[model samples]
Target chain A: MKPYELTISQAHERLKQKELSAVELTRSVLDRIHAVENRVNAYITIDEKLALDQAEIADGLIARDNMTPLTGIPLAIKDLICTKGLRTTCASRILENFVPPYDATVIEKLKSAGTVIVGKVNMDEFAMGSSTENSGIKITHNPWDLTRSPGGSSGGSAAAVSADMCLGALGSDTGGSIRQPASHCGIVGLKPTYGRVSRYGLVAFASSLDQIGPLTRDVRDCAVMMNVISGHDAKDSTSVPKSVPNYLDFLNGDLKNTVVGIPREYQSARGLDSDVADAVTNAIQTIESMGARCVEVSLPHTEYAVAAYYVIAPSEASSNLARYDGVKYGFRDRDKSDLLDMYRSSRSKGFGPEVQRRILLGTFSLSSGYYDAYYRKASQVRTRIMEDFKQAFEKCDVLLSPVAPTPAFPIGENADDPLTIYLSDIFTISANLAGIPGLSVPCGFSSGGLPIGLQIMGPHFSEGQLLKTAWHFEQAIGIQDRKPEIGS
Target chain B: MKITPEEVIHVANLARLDLDEAVVEKVSHQMGAILEYIDKLNEVDTSHVQPTTHAIFLTNAFRDDLVHEHLERNQALCNAPQRDETCFLVPRIIG
Candidate 1:
């Protein structure tokens, strides 16, 4: 296998033995990126010199027998996370030239562990869209088929990992951003429980729903990355003061007493592709044959998730994104005569149409007359959705469903249709809504040969259990060993 | 509620976005359709349920009062589109 194709665990083993230096591994990944980046368009920035410099330092740590699992691993960061000198654009032109003065907490953690920072990946502008076509910077194409979207707003993260541009990438999940893309790109994407990972510098979309997690080629790599990024931080009040488990240790490979619940609402939802349904149904059967019990459960409020999410996410977005006015650090209209005009013109020109649409939707939802009708109603419905998950967990260990209603769709298929795109996140958004851990693992491919993903969701902080179950199922299916023909 | 072109422009102004009249018309139709679909929530009664702003229960998270190192003045201003040596430069606000 190519060095760039190595999982974090595999790379760690080779580096520890001195069989592969961090520089060689980083170079192989960068070479792979340099080879297909034009076609894949995964990264917004690739700082080769800085990446190699970090790899050299990682090599120094490895030689002294002092290292973390991620020590020599080259990982791509979603542009949302702040890196001291790197341009963290969040794939929006408003912040296109903006660079942070300090590292986000996760970046600080990764740097301290001696990992190589490859570059920033593309995302939907401000993480407001399901497809990366909403990216103000670049459109990240799926590795499986260049004509298709990789999924977003974590599209670049997923695309980079699938193409072996990087070993693993960090992605933020707000309404299936991470998992959906991972599904599309044929890799593993894990969205930890809300508050499980600190949202300190994760540029807020819906402050209540967003959580940062990893996208990797396999489940164990997900676990390895999870161990490094999950922890409590003082900077984020929402960071749960809870115990951080050694997630890798959960990969014991036994699903002996596990109960996987299949949500009926999801199984019978509108627009669910028959191929995706069959693949997920097969995944449940595979786990059952492996000694786990499969039971049908219902999350009655599932139909209302997208409706609630659209209102809640954007309303919060309107407030959180309020910081991007002309005055601060991002784009500013120098020609405007006054402050308000400057604010209006700068934002109008800096943001794309989808972003503008969302901001308007948000502003309307949160306006005084409509707040009770839209925003407050959405929040109340959100509570009921959380309650439904809580009730279902009483019957099962984890919920098994399709990550998306369908496999990766053609680019621009729903670009102009906001409602269709919003409905695409039906299955995965509930996990984000309820603040539960969710994972998207490659199950089977569509008749069109596009990869379909099985979404495994668990109760709050059940990441360890979720990863373990996905690991067992992955081992049985052995799909992670398969690679896209584009790079392979 | 039926969203109007005038409403779209109003919301855009509230959002600090100066949009074209055509874009506002497009958005008005789009947002109107979205709001009509989201009207699905009105079918469910949530009068008794408390609104949840966050998934997990958390309250004020305080930090130590001790002084800690922060970014230098120059580093803080590095990404500013228009900044003087001392601060960010914006259009006249107090005139």
Candidate 2:
């Protein structure tokens, strides 16, 4: 296999054996990026000189035998994560030229691990939409099928990894942003427990629901990344102070005592494509044959998840995104003569339609006479959703379900109907609402050849167990080697 | 309609977003549909439940008052759309 095609573990092995240098690997990936980027459009920015320089530094570290697993690895970052000196757009024109003054805590951690920073990738503008078509920058096509979306708002991150544009990527999940894209792109994506990873530098989409995690070609690579990026940070107070376990230790590939919960509600969920349901059924059988037990568990509040999420996410987003007013560090409307007019014009012109829609929805929900009915009601429903998970977890070690209701649809399939896109996230949004970790592993392919992902979720800080369960399933399936055909 | 164009305009003003007439019409329809869907929350009897603003229980984080290195004035002002040597310049707020 070419160097760009190697997973993080494989690249690490070759680098350790002196069979490859970090510089060569970085160069190979850069070349692959240049060759296929026109078709994939996975990246918003590419700083080759900076990436090569970091790889050179990695080579020195490797030569001294002082290196972590990620040392010398090339990784893509979701544009929302702050990388000092690199323009972090968040796929919104408002911050199109805004460069963060400092690295996010995760970026700092990755840099210390000696990973080469490839560049920022696109996302739905401010992470407001289910597809990257909301990106104010560029649309990232699915590597599996160019006409289909690489499900988003982490579309570019998934597309980058799936197309071999980068070894691994960091994508933040507010509501299935990471896992859904990984599902569509046929890779492994993890949304760690809400406080498992610090959000100090992630451009806030919805403060209480957002978490940063890894998207990689395999479960092991995801674990490798988790080891480096997970843990408490003084910078982000919401980050848990709990100690992080070495996630790699959990990937024993043994499923002998595991109990998997198959959500009864999920089986009968509306809009669940038959192809996806069949794939997940086969996945359950594969796990069951490996000496694991599967039980039917009911999360009765499942139907209300999208409703609660749409309200809560947009509410928090309205508050969190209020800082952009053309005054401090984003787009400005110079022609406006007054301050309020300037704020209005700058935001109106800077934000995309989806973003505007969300801001309006959030503002409406929080406005006087509406707060109790919308925001408060959603919060109450959120409490119910969390309780449902708590009760379900009492019966099973992990919950298994399809990541998305279906494989990736065509690019513009649900663009005009925001409500339709919101409904599609029903399967994955509950995890974010309940503050649990979720893993999406490639389960099978649709008859149309699009990928389907099986989501494995566990209680808060249960990433180790989730990773182990996913690893076992991956090993049994032996489909991680499949690659999208991005012709030369 | 669940929400009217006038309501959209009112909320847009509250959010400090300047939506033109066409966008106001479009957003009014879209927001109306979304709100109608969100109305599904009313189906649950949450009368006795405590609202959950955050998923995880967290206490307020306290830190020492000791001075620490922070963004330099230049770094802080670096990305400003309009800035002087030290301050971000904005449209006049005072008469």
Best by TM-score: 2
Error of 2 at A231 (Å): 0.3
Tens-digit lDDT string for candidate 2 (A1-488):
89999999999999999899999999999999999999999999999999999999999999999989999999999999999999999999999999999999999999999999999999999987778999999999999999999989999999999999999999999999999999999999999999999999999999999999999999999999999999999899999999999999998958888999999999999999999999999999999999889999999999999999999999999999899998888999999989889999999999999988888899898999999999999999999999999999999999999999999999999878999999999999999999999999999999998899999999999999999999988998896456999796
Which tens-of-lDDT digit does each residue in A216-301 have in candidate 1? 98999999999989999998988999999999899996999999998989878999999998998898899999999989999999
Quality of candidate 2's docking, in CAPRI categories? high
True contacts kept of 2: 0.96
Model 2 gets an lDDT of: 0.94
Give the top-scoring candidate (DockQ).
2
DockQ of 1: 0.84
In the order shown, what is each candidate's alpha-carbon RMSD?
1.1, 0.8
Model 1: lDDT of residue A175: 95
Candidate 2: which stretches are off by over 4 Å? none
